[model samples]
Structures are given as C-alpha cells and as structure tokens.
Target: MSEKFKITITTTLTLVEQFQSTLSSSQTNAGQRPNPSTNEQNKDLDPLALLSASATALKSHVTKLSLLTLTSPFTASAVATTLSTLNASVLPSLVTAALLVTPDSHTAAFQSEIRVLTNTALKELFFLVREIQAVAEAKASKKSLDQSEKDTVTLAAGRVWDACDVVIDVATKGVVGFVVRRAEEYRDLVRDAVEEIEEWDPDEDGDEFFDELLDDDNEDRPTSGDSDDDDEDSEEAAAALRARKKDTLRVLKPIAQIYPAIITNRLKLVPVPLVPSDVKVLESLMRNLQQIPEHIDEVAGALYEEDLQKYTSQVGKTKDCASRAINLVVLPWAAKQSSGDQETVGDKFTTWSKTWIKVMGEVSKSIDKT
Candidate 1:
C-alpha cells in the first residue's frame, strides 16, 4: 500500500513536470511570459503591484482596485508595482481610473456598452500590460511557480472562463436523443390531428349502429332516455367518437413502429462483478478524467479520493471514464499480444476504450496509477 502511494506521487510529479515543460516551451515560442518568471517576481515584491496597475490613459476605461483587492497575481507589492509599471509603459497619464477590479473599468461614454466594453476594453488592457516590466523586479518569485503551478492556474482559468455554453443531446439513441424523440412525446404532439379526425369517425360508426337499430329479425328495440338526443345528431356524436378512436390509433401508429427499435437497441451495461471498494475506487478515478484537459491537481485529487459526484456532469461530456483504466489502456494493450485475425473480447474493449479515451486524459492517467 505504501509503495503504491509512493509510486502514485512520483508518477504525478513526473507528469506534471512533463506538462509544464511543454507549456513553458510553447509560451516561449509564442513570445508570451512564462508564469514561473512572474512567480519569482511575486516572491520578492508584492502581489498587489501586478494586479492593480495605474491605468493613466486607459484609466478612463479602467476600474480602480482598492489596496486590499489589488494584490499581485502572486502578491500585493507585485500587484502595485506591476500596475505602476504598466501605466508608465502604455497609455497616456490622462486616460483616467475607475478604481475597481476587472475588465469592469471603462470611460463614461461606454458605460452602457456591456458587450463592447468588456471585450474591447480587455483587448486594450492587454496591449498596455504587454509593455510593462512589472514582472522583472522580483527575482525570487520568477523561479518558484514551476510547471505544475502554471498548469493548474491555466487549467482552472480555462474551466471558469470557457465552460460549455449549451447542453444538447444529438448522439444517436443515447439518453439525450431518446428523451427528445420518445414515443410518448410523439403521441402528445398529434392531439390536434386526432380531434380533426374524430368528426369523420362518427359517420363510420353510424353505419354499424344502423345495422343494429333496424334488425329485421327482432321487433323489439332497446330504447331508454332521450331518444331525440339519440337521433341523427347523436349518430354524428357516435361517428365523432369512432373517428376519435381512429385518430388516436393513427397518431400512435408511428410509435408502435418505433417501439420495437427502441427495445432492440436500448443501451445496456455489462455488469462487471467487483468488490464494492474496487468499484468505488474505479468510479473515483473516472471522475478525475472528466476534469482532464483543464484543471489538474484539484481534479486529480478528487478522482484519487473516489469522489464520484464531482465529475458526474463532466463525465457525461465524454466516454472516457467508462473505459478509464483496465478497460481501455491495459486491456487494449494486452489484446494486441494475442495472435489472431479477429480480436477477442479484450480487443473489443480496447477498441472501445480508444474511441473515447482522448476525451478523458486526466482520468486515464489516474487509472494507470491505480
């Protein structure tokens, strides 16, 4: 158990380092500042200096930050200093400050301009931020943020900022598709058509009723109350009732045809017998994969701990968690070892796993650890 824990930790450290290196190089190539450099600056100075920069010309469009809130990406001094550096590097002294946090700041003329102000002002702010040497002053913080920290920050920022805008289910016969196009829903949709058809059905029913009403073999007729009400007009109502029944049948006919298909192709889970504890752990690992392509450590920890609900929503986005560990990676690899033209069940599982694993990296890596 202890060895497993050690192995897991060591593997995670290595992976985080690998990711950090990739990102570091990418940012360098793109001519963007690496986060670690700013971390070092943050350690030496303060956070506020960086976040609450003096926006002179941009001030008319920039919101002011209180000293309390104007902390650096890493510290207070860094925030203030970075802000000051930015004001000097970009924008004239007269732009004006709104004295708040955000892309929220803007000139009075654009106060009502919600969409334009937020987007346009941010673009302008970044332009000014680019020229500043706010990060240059802090030697200590420049080295400390490291690869993992950068990945974590970047991932979380993306999660909060770029989350899915809409949830729609168009996947073939999946939960989403079935709910939207089920038989019952079709039945309700055609009630108006049924009403129109009801008028015609009563006439059809009247012909049959006439045969019963004028039976030549019997002299007695079964007559009760309201014979006038039961006259030709009543026959129309009878016809209507018959028509209604036909209409209802017609409306439901499509569902009858589709019902068989629903039965034949409904999704089924092949149960794998495992100890409760194992299932719990597996589910936990799956949750983490759902968080992949974004936040790392926090989501990873959640998966490791077997917190299933944490990634329930994210899990639905992809098929990754379904085949996270043995199902996709280990099993598929093993299947390749077998010599045969056709794949075994193991190979089938591996094939399925591969299909969706790209969507669940964080989860798979955790599964590999387990």
Candidate 2:
C-alpha cells in the first residue's frame, strides 16, 4: 500500500478498536460531562433520526470501500476518505445518540437494543474494513486477486448492508414498539412450553411398564422362593409409583395453562413511557417474566422423573415468581391511584393472582396424595 493509504487504514482501525473497547467496558458515558445547554438542545435532536442518518452514512462508506478496483488510480484515496469519515464522524455520533436516550429508564431496554444493533453494524463495518485492508495489501504485493478474495469482500459488504438495514428498521420501531415486540417474543416462548407439556406422554417411553413386566417375570422364577407377601408388596409399590406419575402430570397441565395468561396480562398492564421511578420494579417484573419458560421446564422435568418433592419445590418457586410479578405491576399502579381506585386495581390483580396460586396449589395436593 502507498504510505498515505497505510497511514489512513492504521488510524481508522485504531479508532474503531478504541471505540469498541470503550463500548465493551461500559464506558460510553465516561467522558460525557453534563452540558445543560447541550442537553437542552439535544431535547429536540431526535436520536432515531441521528441513528438513521448515521446508518445511511456508514452504508455509503461500505459501498465505496467495496467498489474499490485494483486498476483504479483513485482506489487508495477512496479507501482512505471512506475510512476517515466512518471512524472520525459517523460511528461516534451514532453511539452518542444511542446512549443519549438510554437514561430514560422506561425505554432503557429498547435503547439498549439500539446500542446492540449499532454495535452489530459496527462489527460488520470493522470486518469490511479488514477485508478492504487485505485487498490493499494484495494490490501492494502485486498479487493477483483470486475469485475467493473478491467474493469475500463482496460478502463482507453485503453483511454490512444487512446490519445497517436492521439498525434502521429497529430505530424506526422506536421504544414502545420494541418493548411490545419483546413481550411477544416472551409470549411465544411460554406458549411453546405449554405445547410441549400438552404433547408430552409419560407412558410413551414405556420404561416403567417394561420394568414392571421384567420384575413380574423375575418374581415368577422364584430363585430364592420369596413369599407371596413380598410379591404383593412389590406390585403395590409399582402401582403407587404409576399413580403418582399420573397425578403429577395432571397438576402440571393446569399450571402450564397459566403462563400464557400471565404474559398476556403483563403486556396489557405495562405502561408506555413508563414512570421513571417505577423502573426498578418493572425490571424485576420483566426478569420474572423472562424466567417463566425455564421454570416451566424445571417443573416439567421434575414431574417426568416422578420426583414429587422436587416437583413441589419447583412449583412453589414458579408460583412465587408469578405472584411477585403481578404484585410488581398492580402495587405500583395502585399506589399512584386514589383509595377507591387502588381497591379496584388491587381486586383485579388479586383475582388473577388467586387463580395462579390455585393452579399451583394442585402440585401440593398431588404431592400429599402421592
């Protein structure tokens, strides 16, 4: 590569790596001193607009870099200019705009999502830059460009385009839409768990039945001349084990039915432009909601193993998660209401909590019966 071209590439790569390092260490806010006037001006700045503009600019740069031809006299200068613009201007602006909106706790998750999307785009850009550098080196060394080398650069550019498009699309969705989309993802997971439970048949494996027949055959052989009382006891124990397995599955079905309802109700209850003061409670509620699918898996596994004790324990934990999530929503909203409104809100959520608890109660009853 020419001296100027090498310098530009090195500087650009250094800047991109430094920025990525800063982001990885959660230090994006490190040097951002509070400027009241700047903050006031930024109120009307529109982060989404900035994001879209930056993504567009980055895409344009990637296009220029990807189109560089070995014979073109201006290829080196074009690469240098594009890299300089991307490293010095577009990326920093995009990251700053993304971080600017993240302080609003209500939209923090969505804003974090924007950061993630932006980071992904940056990564793709970095990869493309590296690919361009490789091409520059090849040209410098008078190496003939192989078809694979050409394809690699094209593919890298395509990825950058795709990544930038995703960032733009997500920015267009804004915060409320993003949150709703995430809730939909959670709902799908819970629904999947419900379907899995519904379709599961304990006897499909036939391990217990086969074992029982083997035991029966062994009993008939009577190598040690076991008493009839011993044989009767063995049969009764096997029957009891089968009965317990059936009861556990029965309890699991109803509990599985409750998860979708909880997720749906949560989506309805979540306030848009969430109150900043309630962010922590809302975060806790979201955490619980996210764990529902995993908890369902745990309880179902315990039930399948016919470990009634473990099943009862896991069910209790799941019930607590549901109850706490409901209270997080209801109590915060109700606390902000007048006495009569509070009572009404409390009643509404109490009814829902009761139904969940009642279904969860079946596990205890099943355990006791077993």
Q: Highest lDDT among the candidates is held by which one?
A: 2
Q: Please write out the lDDT profile of model 1 over residues 1-370, one tens digit for every residue.
A: 1343334333433432443344334433433333665445444432122212322223422232212122234343433443453345422211111111111121111111222222333343443232122222232346344445344334432332221110111111222233224333433433333333343333333366777657665676547654565686667765644543443333223322322232222212212222333334333433333233233222323333435444333333223333342342234222334564434434443444454345345433433332
Error of 1 at 310 (Å): 52
TM-score (C-alpha, index-matched) for candidate 1: 0.18
Off by over 4 Å in 2: 27-49, 69-74, 101-115, 141-144, 204-272, 330-340, 343-370
The residue-by-residue lDDT of candidate 2 on 27-101, one tens digit each, is 355334446776787866777878888888888878878886433443787778777787789888877676565
Q: Which ten residues in a row have the lowest lDDT in candidate 1?
A: 163-172
- Please give the RMSD to the true structure for each candidate, in Å: 25.0, 5.0
**Candidate 2, pairs of clashing residues:** none
Q: What is the clash count for each candidate, in the order shown?
A: 55, 0
Q: Would you list the C-alpha lDDT of every candidate in the order shown?
A: 0.32, 0.68
